[model samples]
Structures are given as C-alpha cells and as structure tokens.
Target chain A: MKVVEIRPPYLIFLGSESRATYAKTGAGLAQWRPELCSGQLRLAADTVDLGLPDLTLEQAAEAGVGSLVIGTAAVGGGIPEDWYPVLREALSRGIDVVAGAHKRLAEVPGLSESAAAGGAQLVDVRVPPAELPVGTGKKRRGKRLLMVGTDCAVGKKYSALCLERDMRAAGMKADFRASGQTGIMIAGCGIPMDAVVSDFLSGAAEILSPDNDDDHWDVIEGQGGLFHPGYSSVSTGLLIGSQPDAFVVCHEAGRERISGWDDFPLPSIEDVIARTVELGVLVNPAIHCVGVCVNTSSLAEDERKSYLAQLEKRLVLPCVDPLIDGAEAIVRGLR
Target chain B: MKVVEIRPPYLIFLGSESRATYAKTGAGLAQWRPELCSGQLRLAADTVDLGLPDLTLEQAAEAGVGSLVIGTAAVGGGIPEDWYPVLREALSRGIDVVAGAHKRLAEVPGLSESAAAGGAQLVDVRVPPAELPVGTGKKRRGKRLLMVGTDCAVGKKYSALCLERDMRAAGMKADFRASGQTGIMIAGCGIPMDAVVSDFLSGAAEILSPDNDDDHWDVIEGQGGLFHPGYSSVSTGLLIGSQPDAFVVCHEAGRERISGWDDFPLPSIEDVIARTVELGVLVNPAIHCVGVCVNTSSLAEDERKSYLAQLEKRLVLPCVDPLIDGAEAIVRGLR
Candidate 1:
C-alpha cells in the first residue's frame, strides 16, 4: 500500500521478454500499478543499449544515475552476451539496478557475473525468496514447524513469517529456517541453521556443502525437492548439524495422498517418530503440530477443521491455523 | 492425553474376516499391548475359535449375547465378511454392538450389508467432523469463505473448526463444508465445496467444482494435499469455476520452502490480482491478511514479532494469529 516515486533523472532498465510474469507494460499496468511506488514520471523513457556493454556503461555513467531499474527477461538455459558484461560493468561502478524478471539471461554462468562488480547491485523486480533467521545466539525453540505446499503461490513464506511473529508474541526464541531450495536465497537473510534437502536440488551451497565433511551447522542449508535424490540424507545431515529441538514441516493440506505409490496413508505418527529415532533423534512425539494455511478462495472453515483435526488426533499434536498460531506452536513445541 | 477404560461381557460381532481376525490373534495382540487395554486379563490366552459367520440373513437371529463388541482384522480397509451376520443378528436380537472407528466404514458398500445382517448398531469411538451452518435464509454478513491446504493433515480441520467457532462467536452465518474425502466421511458439516486439489485428489470434479455449478453467497470448502496430481487439475478447474469472491489459502508455517524443478516463488500480489481479473473475478490486489500459527515453547515475543513484521512488509499481507483472528479477519474481508 506504500508507494515510492522515481523520476526520469535516474536510469530505467526494462526486460526483453515476458515469460511466466506480469506484462507490466500492457493493460494490466494501470489496474495493477505497483502500490509501493508513487509519484513517478521523472524519467519518461530512456532505453540503455543492453546489447552493447560500452554503450550501456557510457549511458549509466553519463546519466550519473544513482538508481537503475531494469526489466526482466525469460529465464532458462543461458544469459544474453551483451546483458552480462553490461550488468557486470554496471555493478563494478557501484550503481543500483532494479531489473525485470529474466532468468536465462542472468543466472547463466559467465553470463551474469556473481556479485555486483564495482559495488553495483541488482534488485530482482519480481518476488524474491524470503529471508531466514540469521543472527547470533538465536536459539531455535519448537517441536517442529511445518509449512505445506508443493507449488509456488501456495503461501509458504507468508505462513512462515506469520508463525515467526506469533512465536515471538508468545514469548519464545525462534528463528526461521529453510529446508529446501529457498535456502540459497534465504541465506542472504541470515546464516541458516541447516538445509534439509539442498544437496538433492543441485543448489550451490557455499556455506554448508553436504560433501565436505557432514558437520554443517555453522551456516545456512536447504531442502531440495519433494522426493529428490539425497533429500533425506541432507535432512539427516542438517538435523545432526543444527540439532534442532523442534521441527516444522511445510505442507499442502487436503490434497490427495501422493500417487498412492509411496507410503500412502503415509505412516502413522509412531512411524514418523520411529524414523526420527532411527536417525538417532527422538521426537517428542506429542509435541508435533500442523498449521493449515488454506486458500480462502476455495474452502470452508468446517472442511478445513475436519482435515486438520484428523491429523491432530492421529499425529498427537495440536492442529492450528498456520497464519495465526503456527509459529507460536512451533516455538512451544521446542519448549 | 485422556485415556478411559470400558469393560464388556465381551461378545464380539465379527465382520467379513472376523474369524480370520480372531484367528490371527497374535498379530492383534502384538499391535495393542495388554497394558494399554482396559482389562487386566486376556480373554483367550490361546486364541479362541469362536466360529463366526459372514453375511447372514434375518437380524437378531444371529446374536445371542449381551455387551457385544465387533472385531475386525482389516480395520481401515475392505469390509470383512462376518460383520454382516453379526450386525443383523445383534440388531434383531436388540443387542448393541460396540465398534471402534467403524462408523464411517459402516456406510461403505460391503460393511452396510454386515450391519444389516448382524442387527448391530454403530457406536463411533472416533471424533465426529464438525457441524455445518444452519440455513437461515439470511444473507451472510461477510465474504464467501474457502479453506485450502498444501496437503492432507496440515491442520486443515482444526483451523476450520476454530474459524467456524470464531465466526459464529463473532456473529456470522458461516458454515463448514466438505468437498472431497471429508464429504464422504462427515455429513451436514457444510454444503460440499471442493477447491482444485481436493477435486484432483478425489477425481470427482475439477478444483472449482462447486462454484462452476452455482454462484451464490458465502461458501467454505476444505482442501487437501499440496500440489498432488489431482491438486493441479482440480485447482485449474476451480479457477475456471465461479471466480472466488476472495481467495484464502491455508498452509503450514515456520517450515522451509519445498522446492521443485519447476516451483518458484509465489507470484506478486499484483500478478495474482491480474490473474483474478483475467478470470473475471474482482478482488482487492493486496492479500487481505495472513494468519500465522506458531509453537510457543521457547521463543521470545520480540523474535516472533520482528519476523512477522518483516514478512508482512514483504508479502503485503497484514499478518495475524490464525487462532485468534483468522476467522474474524475472513469475516471482515467479506465486508
């Protein structure tokens, strides 16, 4: 709801393609104008030559722009040649650049240079991964916290943040951690206690690589995929490194059991507890809880309650509204 | 946490595999320890051969015992044979048969026959699903409701129940409903509402099945699973259904993101609003609010609050404790 305005005196960066993103330039613009940005129109239309590094560099320097906003392009495979050096050179000059969503052009190796060169920065215009709890002496308190979703736009980060707030409100010491791919991005937030499935996802972990001597609690780590290779292995490794007193699992509720292929009616609570024990850890068993975040557009309260209650009774943990009490409950579980 | 003891004259009405269940006494005994049972002594230390029949006609004729309990080996699966004769006989003879967690099963195909034959009535030991709102013919005061989850047992039921209770307490006509598996298990909780994943898991209809058929006042449906195969199909279907008045998603909080090769961060609220409009639904672009539930074992209030605040700023959803204000917020959103 807060809007910040930028005028034409600064640099403007736009993306070349629109893949899996909002076409901000089209009709959706006026209707869905960014509420965060207000009082604009200083810079009308100034297109820098992304195809030419020298031209791009000259334009940036000539403009003496303190802030640069760039649009994103399609993300896949590799990055565009001109875009790479242009971005790299810009970063080296200590400029701030905000660009549109473009993966193929930015993420490719040797294409988008890692780190802002010359102190330049890039702000991904699209949504970014959430920050994690990264600070010193931050004790993790909770039996286990779980966020449920297999797809994007399922409200996972929202759920986690809400829980973090509630846990603190309830007077608990809790830190937000990641067990999946977001771990890499989350690290920017703080040093993660452990990454549950990072190894399986092929994510590059600079802080805690699973291969270099399994003791990796000194930094952040993440989970890979739902059923990725070595996911359980990495999870076990993280568990050992951080030795979390509690656990939180992210999940999607009311969805059918997975494919009926692997462990449908998955295991009883006892089974899961047993697995935890097998890993040389003993689950409090009764301390586990599930927070069910629902798509309000699609379900009823009663329906939501029934499914969660079944889990509560079966799992021997209290089922709660994740947005409301999930974080608090996780902290409590740690207690 | 609460345990009770019940003693019976111990007449056992058998279902289809009652005899087999009784014969495989060792397995049953192994599953439930003597210490956990109500009674001090085992009825038959050496496995009794009580010779039970399957599918008998003429209720009450088969039952000649008092304080009878129904026993079955396949507790959760296919209907057993001996149950019919026992139920019919029990009912005919005016004998009440006590069964554990079989009420839902009694409504199933084969089990219905067994109950008729043994004349045995169902006494459900399991907790019942919550009740639905009574039809008042008065238009609801708040927004139409929908509850969804990432997967099964992510606290959907508990959250729904809590919401229903809160809404009713706050003076709303909101009712709980079942759309997918819960519908078959519980009745009169609410009108059946199924979101995308529920329908996909059930394969009964598309995600937005109910809305496609009818567009009326506020409705709530429970969702299950997170991105299961059925979830995508059903969600797409439901999106094509009557566009949701407002979308609310329930998920687990305090856990890391579960990544996929294809999964990415949730779309920005602006993108979501655009999509909603494209689907012909009017919506407030900002996420109404988020309810975060957390475990409060050992977390500090400041820690929780800071994290929640950070999330609120990032997701643009005013976050609250689901247990406290989730239902109330939903009702307010309706306004």
Candidate 2:
C-alpha cells in the first residue's frame, strides 16, 4: 500500500552491468516515476551505456542529486569496493545513496558517520531484520497472499505490489510485504528474505505477516522458483514461510529458460500452477492459486493482448499483466 | 562413511536437559559407539536423569574422560551461561568438551584461553562452514540420494547414515552429507545448513555435494519437514540444494501426529511418498522415491515387524527400520 514518489535529479551509476544485468534496480525509479528522472551515470570505460551523460561522484554531488543509485546484480559477491569512495563522498555531500547489494551499507565501518555528518540517508535495500525469532507452528489469523513465480525476475514483486494497490483501492485491507530489494524500496520496511539466516527464512515470513482479521490481506512478494536450481530453496522457504492462503503465479512471456540457467528449460505454466498449489498445500492444506500475473514486457502490442487472452482461456483463473491492468481479478478471486 | 568412535570415560553434563530433552546428545556417543561409554554425568537435580553419576567438572577431568558431552536440545535459545564456568574449568583441566548448542563454545570470550592453556579441544557441532559461495545451478556430476521425513526427529539423518553404510557395504560409491548439528558431528565436516544465511542454504548443499561420476551416491541428511512449520524452510532448502536423483521417505512408526504439533494429524505414508516424489521432480524431472525408512523404536517388538510389513505392502517401495535392517532393501531399490 506504500509507495515512494521518486523525485528529480536521479543519479544512476552504471556499474555491475546496470543496463541489462541490474536493469530492474538501475532503472526502476525512472520507470516508476519518469517525470522525476534527472539523468543516468556511467563508468568512463562503459561500452554499452544508458545514453545519459556520464557524471562523476563529485559532479553528482555538485548537481545536488537527491539519490545516487548503485543498483546492480552482486548476487554472490561482496559489495564492490570500488563504490566505497563514491558512497562515502556522496554521504559527505548530503546526498542519499541506495544500494541493493547482499552486503549492507550500514555495516560498513565509518559509513554511518559520513551519513550523520552530512544529514543524508544510506539505504541498503537487502538488509535483514534485526532479530528474526524461530517460528512456532501456531496457526495465525488473516489471509496471506504470496506471489509465486516460474523464474527469478519474473515480476513476482511487481505483481504483488499491483495486487496491494488494487486491493486497497477497492476499500480492502491490504499491505505489501516485501521479500526482496526492489519491493523493499517501495514498501520502506521489509526484511530482505535472501539475506537472513536459513533457519529464520520462513520464520521471517511468519513474523512479517501480522495477525489481523480474516478481512485483512497481506500481499507478500515471493522470490526464486521451485524450478530454479540456484534459488529453489529460497522459493520453497518463501512458499512455506509466508503460509499463503492463496498465490498468484508470475511469469514473463516467452521465458523458455531460467535467466542464468541454460541447462534447465522452463516448466509449462500448467506445471507451475500445479506445483505451487501442491507446495502451498504441503504447509497449509487450504491454500490454492487464485490467478496468473504474466509480464508482457517482452511481447509486442498485438502479441501481448493475444497472449493475455490465450492465457486467460488456458489458465481458467484471472490472468493479467499486473503492471498494466492491476491485480483486480486476483483481489476479486481472493474475496 | 567415517564414524567417530567415542572413547570413555564419558562426561555428559546434564546442564540443559539431562534426561528428557538433551539425552540424545549425551547418549548419542554410547549409542553410536557403545563400547566407549564409561558412565554419564549430571547436575544436583534429583529428577529423572540420563542415569549418569553426579560428577563435577574436576572429577570428569581426573577420570580422564575423552570428551565432555554437553548434548542437550535448547530449541529457540542460546547456550546456558551456567555451563560456561564448567566448560572453562574442564578445558583448563585438559579435557575436550563437545557442545551441540547453536552458540559455538569457541566464540565464548575467554573459553579459547582455557582451551589453549590446557591443550584441550573445543568442538562445536553446529558451526556452519566458512565462505559458502552462491550456487550456479549447473548440472552436478553425481547421483545424490536424500532422506526426507514427515517431521523433525523423524530419522532423516539416521536413515541417510544407514543408507550410506548399506550402500558402501554393498560395494557402491556412497557418502553421507550432514546438514544439521548431530549429522555434522557424525560426518566431521558440514555446514549447519539452518544456521547459514538464507541465500546460501541451497548454496551450502551445492558446495557439499562434490562433483563425481553418476555411479556415486551422495546420501544427504535432510533437516526439517515440509509439514513442520518451524523447519520446512530448511527442508525445502535441503531438497532443492541436494538435487537428489532419488529420495527415501523417513517416518517414525506408530506415530499418530507430528512430534510437537498435536493439532496436525499425521499424513498417510502413501501421501508422504507421493508428496516427496512430487516435490523432488519440481527441481529435477527424473527424481523419484526409491524407498522408506521406518523408525520402529517406539513400537513393541512384534508390532515393529507387523507395521513394517504393512508399510512395505502399502508403499510397494523398499521399507526398513534402518537401525535394525541396515537399509539394505532401500539401497537395493536405488541399485
């Protein structure tokens, strides 16, 4: 239900393949709030760039950039040490910096002093909650809706956010519970599910979903996929931990394989629905799928429309490109 | 494949729970290598104890106990501070101490000094491996076998160990991969999968399962159960990370419900087998259920045989009380 209205003078640092690799994080703000985009920043050696004029850290500070974004895919590595001087310099210059790395900026020694000295903020989107207690198998109240996906970067968060917006607009009680970095930025408060201890992964979900009335709905952003080799564990954890009463399967149009995994082919959408329902029931027998959220970003105008129509016919559930149509159908299904 | 032959005189500190709870840790050594059990130790508590004598830390050292066992289950808590003084005192007297608490003994502020001064060993079983990298989801070279269960303490580890022993005895390439504290102690090296970062849960399993020929079988110990709300995440992670070609369902015979969850009626054995296979194939299409390991310790002698017979008749796959039958039939199913 919460959303950050991204302001002007955005500084997009083109490090870690910002264009194609960290495309979502690098361009999410601009895409969500295009009117607020100042420009993009790139490394001097950048071959393929975002076409915005290259701006140095000092220049960005002088320009009074509201936030310097270091949105890149550093999935398995530590924070790139190269960005340290720039982050510290920005912090000293009264400009906030938002990073979506597995490493937390707050944990960097002396970074807090720089931020405090300049009265600027440091947002590490993937930072986990302070203390995630072990889960007790006690039954909870309220309906939890988790966005399950067929692959990583398949609009799981986007679909969940849309559902929340639509749900709230319809005068329903709904809150977006973020599980990853992008969702965290919009929600303002969320535990980066992938960063916490394994034992507390599902427990994190259990703790995040508040015990509210049956009318209340917590729309949780899911991560990974049961078919994703590198991240299926996380997906499974999210599936069981969130304890969803219903799920929306998110899939990108024409995704033949997982983003990085070539050895694995995508399972049929039918299989994904069946698999999620089975996985969900394993934890909560009453849980089932409500709808399908397809990303038509890769399809053409005619193709996108036809794909949605065909999907709706085949899925036998509400199917929509959540970004375009909102998750009204899913919310309707939930009700 | 490697088993620790515990030597006596054994000093089991009944600090956490001498009998009901932590008896497993205190007496596992004797049960695994009974020839080495000299006696047990206990606090001044006059209640039901592990039947070990009341031996002080000093007496334990004087008696030349090989390892002071502090095996007690402290779910959702830290190592009891009261045991610190005893542990330090024992270390100073040249006696190795084995602790299964989630909190590592070496991390204790001054315990390392006592250990160094006494030339004693400090072994913390639940320590996760340092520097577990992210998984690539590339095809691994070996055939891995995993033992999954319906609940925590349903004998996943015990079944895996049995399978490994039987497979190796039958002239197969087999090794047991530990995923929890007890399994880690038995294996000598493994990341405490539950204690690790959430993203690395599956990654830890990927790193542990070495690349070998398809003929080799990695019998990985699974933690938690999909139905056990507290630990399903760990189970999910183990299942996805291990990427087993085949799985064995581990169940405690004559159990009416989950170990701690009185509300949940036990799912039928058929459902468990079908569910595991379904879950397994979500990650690997060829994955299937090969067998079942029944923990018949709770049943009477005659009942154990009849229950296993009924299970075999109903399940069709190999069924066994691993401790008694040595998992020979389960291994045969895999072959």
Candidate 3:
C-alpha cells in the first residue's frame, strides 16, 4: 500500500534556489505532471523559473490549488527559515503544504498550529508509515520492471516514469512505483525507501507495489547503485523486494565517477546488469535486463544518437534517452 | 560509538518461558558473561533455569544488582502484560531495568514513573542513537573482522564474542562490537543494526565499530545472513560498513532450510563465503574469509567432531563450534 497520499493541483514552491539543478523537484513536477500543477511560487527574484505562471498564496487559493509543494532542495535537504512563513500562510489559508525536505512540515514551530487552525493537512512525504512488515520474499502475481543504476541520481526515477507513461500509451497496464521523495510527490503516493527502518527495508518495498493483475506492470523507481559502497544496501533491498521480472539499466553520459564519492568510480553498465541479475534472482529467478536508459543531456544532439546506437549494438538491447527519445522502444521490447 | 550503555551485574528475567531456546538471551548472557550476571529471575514454576541463583526482587536489590535484564523473548518479541508488575517492582527498588525486546521499556505504562521515582534508568537496546552520518565508504585505520552467517540465529554473535575472548587471551588487542539487541546487552553497548533507519544502515554500522589503534582488532557481530531472502539487505549494509579485512562464515549443522522460510533452502557455506568476499571487496579490497563457525549443538559428540573436521578439509579453513571449541583455532588463523 502507498504510505503517503498527496493531493494534486499543486503550487510549486521554489525557495530562493538560483540554479535549475538545485530546483530539480520543481522542474520535474512541472515537466512530468504539468496538468496537476496549477502554478509556481518563488521566494526571490533570482529564483529558478519552472516556466509556469507565478502565483502568491492569495492567488493560489483563489486559483483553487489543493497543495503547495516545496520543490526546491536546500544544500542539506533542509527547509529554510524564510520559507516557513510562506508555508504557514499556505496552511493558514486551508491549503495543505507538502514537503519532501528532511525536516517535517508538521514539526516546524508554528506550521502544525496553522494547519490545525485552517483544518489543512501537513504532509511530509519523507516520513514513512508507522507499521511496515518484514519482507516475506514471496513472489507477487504481476510483472515488475525496476530501474537499476550505476550511480546515484543517474535517472532511475526518470526512466521508471518514462517507461510507465510509454507502457500505458501502448495499451499496457502499468503503474509508476516511487521510492524517493521527489518521485513520491510526482506519483501522488509512495513509500520513502531510505526513511524506513533497516529491518523493514525490503518489507516496505514489497508493500509499495503489492500483488496485482497477472498482466499488469509496476515500474519501480530504484534507489542507489547496486555497486555503490555506501547506499548499495538500499538498492539491494529494493531489488529483492521488487522481485522484478525485467529491469532497465540507467546511466548518465559523461559521468566517470559516483557523485559525492570521488574515491569510487562508477561501475560499468555490464557490471550493473550482471550484478543486478545475480541478486535479483534471489526473489525473481526469471529476472533479466530489457533495456538501457541513459541521460544524454550532457552530449551534443548528434553525439547522443550515435552514443545510444553504439550502446544498443554492444549490449544487444534497446537503448534510449528517456527524456529525449521517450521509452517507446523499451516498451516495444516488453512484449 | 555504542548506542546504549547497560550496567553490569545483571539480573536476568526469564518471564514464564519454559523452553531454553526461547530464553536464548538469558542463556547467552549467563553463558558468555557469568561474572557480570548476579542471578536469574523466573516468573513461572517451570521456567528454564540458567543455573544461577534464583533471586527475588528484594534479594536482587539487597544483592546490589545494577540492572534487571528481560532475557526471554515471547512469541512475537513483545513484552507480556504479566511482566509489568515485576519490572515496576525492580524499578521501584532503584534497580535499572534493561531490555532488548521489541517493545521500548520507557513506553511501558507506569514503568517510566517508577524508574523516575527510584532514580533508575530504563534502557532499551533496540533503539538506535539519534544522530548517525551516512556511510562515506572511506577506509578507516585498524584491522577488522566480521562474523557472517547462512541464516538468522546461526551463532554469528556467539562466534564474534568467542573470537574476541580468544584474541584477547592470545595477547591481541581486540574488542567485541555488538550489532543486535542481545549482543548490545551483553557488551553493555552497541548499535542495533536492524533498528536503524534504512538510509543509515551502513552509517550506523560505521559508527558501531569506529577506527581504533593500528594493531587493534574490532570483532564486529554480524546481523542477518547474506543469503537470507528477507534480511540480506541488512547484511549487505553491515558488510559494506564494517569493511572487514577478514570474515568468518557461520552456519548451523543439520539445518537444510532457512528458518521460517522453508520454501528457500539454506545456501551452502561455500556460496556464503564467495558472496561475502564478492560484496565485501567494495569497502575493503583485501577482504578474505578467515574461518568457519558451525552451530553443532544438535549433533552428537562423535558427529560434531567429524562434521567440523570434514568442513575444515573441504573449505580449507579452521572450522569449530565457538561454544564447544572456543574459537581459538579461528583466532590463530587471523594472525
């Protein structure tokens, strides 16, 4: 079952983030689910623009926005003090304030009281449900496709979202299963994998995507690289719990080292595919790689095509940039 | 650093447990650290005896017991309602009450008030420390050894404790680092691996056994088995965080299936050793297997020796029952 349920028709809040990279959450929501998002809220003049109409709390309320989502992440994933006033005002106006930040919105000094005063909910997507069962390792009755990565932030979420959209477009039954804060926000409901207690990591993953129809597909967003020294445990648990029948290897072009861990180089795509199969077999013996999703935004337009083509030839699998090329090729291979 | 600090001279509470196996926590403490234990307290007539003097609350108080440890585990690891009166009486007498049970001691009704009235601490070994850093995957100074297993409750903790004792006896600088509730209570301090948040599993493990002197050895007690379907994620995180220079494989003789997960067969010792080394090299490239530890309690005296001897020959490593053979053979191989 989904742990947190976030209301849509959101007003994206970009809290003084000048760089688009730092405002990924806001950008992602605006890009992927523009229909659910009503407008944007910026704290400063220099804040990154998500290309949506800017709206104040009064304007957002009048516009019938359901929730104000904090889209910008601070350096340490914390909620800034200046944003608290805006959040309090949003809650005081009877609009729920949703945050994927490290600090819980309900725990902020005056936010909960304001929310109570307006009869609005304070939703913290980062907080997991109180009760989570230990994973039984029993296979569920549905097809699953998990996005495995060679490094953190290598487009696992983007790949999973793209696959879900493309699969549905192709007349297939598919749902996007989010495992991180931003993905959970976009998906409207999901469990925060890393926030769960260690013993229940796999159990939480199992609950995230329960048994479904035989032909249905749950495109699970993966966390951390399997070869990642620090976060591999999270990845491993998600993999085993997901018990995916198929997986897509996600990687970023022009990246040679793991982000924030310079001492360790990123594992090869072949290594990730092999290791994922090795571990994934513990739960799903029929696990296999179906495609490769690479973020080729760093490469030139001409170079991107050739790069994917070469990779497809070498790996003997469909390769594409989920954002630029869409996951139609990958969806075609699922049949 | 250790998360919980339990005091010495413990009074073990067996709490209506008729089976010695269910009273493993009390039995472990009584067997491993008899010097620190004052006596055992049983609530029922047929409670399994640990051979220590049966002490009443009044007798334990007069005997100067530092803490009363609830040693027996109920069916679901929950504290039975019948245990409240005995726990309250112990706390009312100024004796600190320590428990490694799933339920927190302070949350029990009236227990905290009783502890406050008598100025006694209610220690819960299952709770992790508030602050823990994410694992950096940077190599730390000092040598380390970790005990891994093929399934849960297969003598990983016992083997680590045995190795620590034998290593010290052989004039080696060694410390036993606990990672579970029972191990934490036994060692007076440790991080409960399964209790930590999923994101910080490796981080908590990193803090549990920090850097020591160059010659010092941190013998860390392992958690779940690497091949365990439900628990392998915890094992993976701990393995990465511990980054053991040497490891010992733990298994139980006469058991061919995973406990509670009979559908899955127990992985062979060789499979465990190979997998441990494969994953362990991420943090420490020099990681290698030092020996094998088998729980041979179910085997006859003649069968036990032959079992270990054949294992030693096949695996080409020292094989012993930490309880029966004292782990001296494994300690010798460490050097």
Per-residue lDDT of A1-335 in model 1, one digit per residue for the tens? 01112222234344344242522322122122232221121112343222322225456656565544443333452344555655665566665544434342246344235344455455543322233211111123323343423222345555555565566577554344443322212212322222111111112122222222222112222231122111222233333333333344444554333322232222233443443333223112233223334333244777776766776677666555565335455445444
lDDT by residue (B134-248, candidate 1, tens digit) is 1111112234444444433344554555555566676665544444333212222222223111112222211212332132333445443223211222232223232334554
lDDT of 3 at A200: 91
Q: Is the docking of candidate 1 incorrect, acceptable, medium or high quality?
A: incorrect
The candidates' DockQ values read 0.01, 0.57, 0.78
Model 2, B169-218: lDDT tens per residue? 99999888877777765554566788878777767877778688879999
Candidate maximizing TM-score:
3
TM-scores for candidates 1 onward, in order = 0.31, 0.78, 0.92
DockQ of candidate 2 (2 decimals): 0.57
Give each prediction's root-mean-square deviation over alpha carbons.
Answer: 24.4, 5.8, 2.8
lDDT of each residue in B1-335, candidate 3, tens digit only: 54778888999999889998898889889988899999999888999999999999999999999999988888876888898999999999999999877778877999999999988999988889888888889888899999999999999998999999999999999999999989988888899999898889888888887888999999999999887778999999999999899999999999999899887889999999999998999889999999999999999999999999999889999999989888999898887
Please state the CAPRI-style docking class of candidate 3.
medium
- Report backbone clashes per prediction: 189, 0, 0
